[model samples]
Target chain A: MTSLTSLASSRTPADLLRTSATAVWIFLVVATVTSWALGTDHAFVDNTTAASVVVLLLAFVKVRFVGLYFMELKDAPLPLRALIEAWCLIVCALTVGFFLAG
Target chain B: MTSDVIDAPASPATAPGKKRRIPGEEGTWIFIFGDMCVFAVFFCVYLSARMADPAGFAHDQAELNQNFGAINTVLLLVSSLLVVLATRAVHSPALKRHAPRLLAGAWLCGAGFLGIKALEYAEKVHHGITPQTSDFFMYYFVLTGLHAFHLVLGLAMLTVLIRFASKPEMSRGQFIFFEGGACFWHMVDLLWLVLFPLIFLVR
Candidate 1:
């Protein structure tokens, strides 16, 4: 078993900014702005069920990005990754299902 | 300190024949997933309540300041990014010196989130919009209040992480603890990502 403290190192501060995490952060910010616009009164789109669904879907997608990237689950072992993916899908499906059913 | 002493995957390239690893202790995931399950129930209950009174819920949801929610989302995202960078720094010999500062930055971002949340709560109270105001407000207060409580815990964890970063070396046990704490912080951020839309955005 590889000890937790024995992992290899190759990244620097500059490399950190260029990593997948940074890219995900940018995407997350943009997605948040899009959701904000969709949810606000000033939105160009109508506040219909479709718009609401889009916003909810966008939120959950952002959640997945945070998990897979920021939480470092993207590089995690298969079982752990599978568990989180299942959580995201189940939660998102149930939440959306409830919204649509209403 | 040698790079071998730090914890976590700093390189994109894993060594040949090395097993894929989880980020933190196995027990940590149990708690993380359990807390998530509880919040999942909360989400469903809120949705069910909204279904019963859609019009009232939408009406009251309109009263929420979306700007506050958006800004808070940005704050949390920035904080999460900082935490990610700090964790990477922990794994790099040359970058380890930056870890404490990075964690401190994340702490500030978390503090900013709490500050904004406090302002939001105060504004609601100032306008006489307590939890008793409506079913919507009730869920809003309870859910966000619980989330804020979690954020407070995350901030405390960040403080610990900052201290950990300053240490010259960490034992395998300490590294596992650090990793688990980092995951907990990310869980807080993940919950808010869903909560923001569920409460503030969704019609």
Candidate 2:
């Protein structure tokens, strides 16, 4: 929560929203593109585990950005924010671990 | 910069140094949290199912078009972004008038998602793939179908919020409702973000 105030205060609510949303949007787009490339590229196809981990990890991070900004959890009550953070960490870790292990 | 400043006058709850407060009713978060827990269990069920027959699951997964999932991920993210803009716009007197349009755009993105999903669904059905087709198809349809149901609800909620938010005179109560709805919509998007990779991309 305390870590995110700097970037959010630069503009009016709308401008700040637009700025943060745009930043997240661009980051998501880049992550998706990278995932697509890694998913479809011939060389990467041979390494399914590596490709899967990379793409899934990218998705995990994108989820964090969405939760923090769009969900308005950055400034949420500490317990709520902590809950979300923990959920993300657990879900991502469990899913990736299961994917690789199974 | 430090936790001390946050506790100085604002207390830990307000974190005065942190200028913004979490929007919407705290009660709504309980629902959001509950929904997250329900979905987590669903994901676990999926993992268990996949582990039983990894080969079949992987084969059926390849049948899904990654391009579609990739496209929809961006679409949902953009929608959530627009909702964020609309929610925050209500906070600024100068930008209040623009909230409705931004929200409408967000709603349209939700519509776009359903449209793409329908097409994907139709293609699968045309190939004789259905929930009855196999275990993977069952999970695919059931999981995504449930998610689609949530997306529709999210859209309707957005529309309601837009109606009140766009008005020349909105109550503080209305603004809070709008914020809550926007958060719900983003939760829908967040669920999909996790679902997309788990169901479509991960090998």
Candidate 3:
């Protein structure tokens, strides 16, 4: 249904290198930069709860992206993939709740 | 639960109704899941302590080197990217030749992370900000110190892997070892992603 499916099905090493892994790396760099900017500006101080949520949300996104792609869990069985995603969601949510309500 | 992607002896002959394969042993994932649970408990303990003395924690956190933390984060992410590239490349006969170089590059990035970490630790200790300085420093050292230990172990594991893979052909078991190592390193990076923000940013 989508181009990514075609890309993923393509087994060429160059294709994999130039596609998902690169895309994930770019996203990670951008996310890190964004978080660093927020940290430097001290936005988290303006509203501690809101800032904590944003920062950790970004963290959650980074972790999930790496796990799914680099770890190749995208090709893993449904049960395993579900378990990994559930771990990410639960840990991120509870950690944020801890900081926000701690 | 693993694959012939890297060490097929030769590619598996196509057949209908064959089971799909995983790259590494099932045990690696199980071990990581347990390790993460332990770290989660550590995180909750740290937060509970921080909650009891938020101001003090914040004050100590401010003394940390954020720029160094940011650099280490990038280093680990780059290393992870290289490991994934190496893994994917192993499936292609045309590009498997490049996997060794990709792995070496990843090792350099990991080394860079540890170098910066050592500098950061030395700077703090020189300034008399050891773990004994406060509860904040205590958490900072214990949590990050444990993490740093894993980073060192990861680097060592990669060293062994790169050496093993230097052969013209790696065994299926060796490929699985490579995959498991990649997962472990990524977990290390994953831990730091949250740790960086929690300790250095989320004041």
Candidate 4:
């Protein structure tokens, strides 16, 4: 399969931008639906490790959407995109890792 | 002899536009990275507070209105769609004429979000569940308040885009500013997606 950036850039500018937005919307909807379903307490507050993991994974997905499409990383040069993604992964991993470790 | 080859468009010898790079765009990414760090600290604080007093956190969390939170998430999702459509419309030769509609739709969606959020706050206040009532409430107020403030700013940015869209002489380069603002707005939206589950949905 063609790489994501190559596919995006190959489209007319209009399609590229539309695909970017629609992808995020779809991702958010799926996340929200999954979260609502996995929620143990619809009317109350309950915390389960399963729910926590799901939310964390959703956060990662959202981060990817913002970094790739909204921030135009899809069109960015390879080194710049790599730099941004690397920093984000380190920050997120450290934060979540510290919490989980503690 | 090789000069002709060097003149080719694909040749590395050719200078790119302006032959200069912008560091401000690079700086914005760093700024965003810093913002993420601050949010992480807050996340840690939230987690620890809950861990120390899971019972209290759960009680306080129960006081939240999930219906409103769900509605707001939907609104933000729609607004994200509008922003995407607007960005796409700008690039269309035929649909470019309707760019104003696309942008206006985005602004409307953003404004709708603020309106709904205010209603949610008002409902909470009416129920006597003020932020100071508990530590969970405190975090909820601060986090959601900041998010709402960003929405307000995002709406204002959309207004600016609308103003430019109405102009006859606006260039495609000008849309980059709108795109930058939209990117920040999307970040705001993404933050809320995380907040909704962490604060309202999960135990």
Candidate 5:
């Protein structure tokens, strides 16, 4: 367990929470607008794929926001946070790798 | 006369006053983590199948309505913001009284998400594009169906938390648990953001 002092030493817990929410909202809005403008047509080719990739990257950023802020993983002991994030990343990598290869 | 053990002070192990650590929270996290892995595998399988039949997948993907997907994404992202606000309200003495209302707002947003998704699905099915129509359709139905299930569960958790919001026994820290559940639900929504464009909008 982490010390309360260390937890409080950084941005007050409330500030961190607010910052995370703001960050997630900005990310979502940006992705929505960009994808809409750029992906108006179902190109099915390289352009669409590029747009999709950008959206997916944005998804990754949003997930990080949720995990660190709402899930309170930022305040958790380092090992536990690493374990959770690492597993998710590995699975994600394997997924993309398998799909890209096939 | 034999002395009665009844109503007597219990042994150290059986002491009623001792706070036994509730294992429920930790166990729930494990369950959720496993659930995430299940989704991860599903995503992988969908991705691989899409790669294998890009042309067919592209054709099916074009049938989907990107507008609806975009709207639903906005709804969910907004709901996540509401949940975060609800958690903050729970912690703040000034706003503690409004926490349930904030949570209710979150649930309403979730319902809106489901409603939009329903309309989208209905329109798709009306156009003669069902899950059986193609491999892409299959992934679309399955992935979105899974997300719908999570949305329902998240709403249920919100309802439960709201019920206890006014109770004296509940503490501000209790909201963190609901916040975590909301986070997972948001992740479900966020995943669809990518899936929609990748599988539907992008064709």
Candidate 6:
């Protein structure tokens, strides 16, 4: 496995773009656009509940990506990583449940 | 880990041995997590209020400019990407020269976010909107306002980071401090990631 330190040592612009951090950035940007499309007034879908749920879930997922990749939590100690993961899951679940409950 | 251990070229944290390590100081993580918990409570409060008046909240949410929220999201994400790259550069001798520039770019992105947020707030006020407008606008202003305060702090942290990155050589303690600052900036981005959808998008 390529270590994060090694990935960060990437020299050129192409090498930089090919790094895992850049890959995660691309994923996050696409996810943001997806959430925007689904939840905005211009949304094609008619189901507000479904759209809201997806948007909320996507937001949390993006949060996790920022924590894991951008913040280097993926390379962190297991206990710390698990704690953050649990936080993400629990908060997301509660948000979804509350949204659906109403 | 002590500074000596961290300063070692073959430090377990960065070596190929794959020893697990926290990105920043343990105290920093504790503070980060604590701050997150507080925001989580804020989120729950907002949701509970929204549930009480879903129709009103949804109606007001529609009035928000999703474009501003989306653009701010992009700006923060890009800023975070720069910070991530800058953090990486800090760890590599060959790339170290670029760290200051990368951090500056991140700082610029943060400034862009603040600029857009100011415009958003002005526009809202121009249309006779304020925190006292309604429950929804109240939460919107309060939540985003608190978030903007954190962003300002993060920008200050980035300024310190740029100064540190400009140094020819950084002590391991300074490096750890840099990592901690970078993590804090990412936390700002993380909060906004949820705030955008919650306040602007979610019905």
Across A48-69, the per-residue lDDT of candidate 6 in tens digits comes to 7899899999999898988998
Instruction: Please provide, for model 4 over A1-102, each residue's C-alpha lDDT reduced to its tens digit, 9 standing for 90 to 100.
Output: 222223323344345343645666677777776666565454233556656666666766776766666555756667767765775576457545644553
Better of 1 and 3 by TM-score: 1
What lDDT tens digits, residue by residue, belong to model 1 across residues B1-203? 46456444433335555456788799999999999999999999999999999999999998899999999999998888888878777776767888899889989999999999999999999999999999999999999999999999999999999998899887666677788899999999999999999999888
Put down candidate 5 lDDT per residue, A9-97, tens digits, no spaces. 33333542445456657766776766765666533446655565555555555556666555556655576467557755775466446
Better of 3 and 6 by DockQ: 6
* Tens digits of lDDT, candidate 3, B127-187: 9999999998998998888999998898888887777666677777787787888888888
Task: List residue ranges in candidate 3 displaced over 4 A.
Answer: A1-16, A42-45, B1-20
Query: Candidate 6's C-alpha lDDT?
Result: 0.86
Q: Which 10 consecutive positions of candidate 4 chain B have the poorest summed lDDT?
A: B4-13
lDDT for each residue of candidate 5 in B32-110, tens digit (9 for 90 to 100): 6677767767877887887788778767766677788778877877777777665555444444566688778888989
Off by over 4 Å in 5: A1-18, A42-46, A95-99, B1-24, B168-180
Candidate 6 residue A46 Cα shift, in angstroms, is 1.2
Instruction: Please give the C-alpha DockQ score of model 3.
Output: 0.44
Off by over 4 Å in 6: A7-10, B1-14
Which pairs of residues have clashing backbones in candidate 2?
Answer: none
Highest TM-score among the candidates is held by which one? 6
- Cα error, candidate 5, residue B191 (Å): 3.7
Q: Model 4 Cα displacement at A41 (Å)?
A: 4.0
How displaced is residue A65 in candidate 3, in Å?
1.0
Indicate whether candidate 3 or candidate 4 has the larger TM-score.
Answer: 3
Superposed by TM-score, candidate 4 places the C-alpha of residue B28 at a distance from the truth, in angstroms, of 3.9
What is the per-residue lDDT of model 4 for residues B79-138, given as tens digits with 9 covering 90 to 100?
Answer: 777766665555444445566777787777778878888898898899998889888888
- Candidate 3 lDDT over residue span A5-94, tens digit each: 233244555575665668888999999977876776644357666766787899889988887877767767777788779888888878
Q: DockQ scores for all the models shown?
A: 0.55, 0.46, 0.44, 0.32, 0.28, 0.65
As for candidate 3, its clashing pairs are none
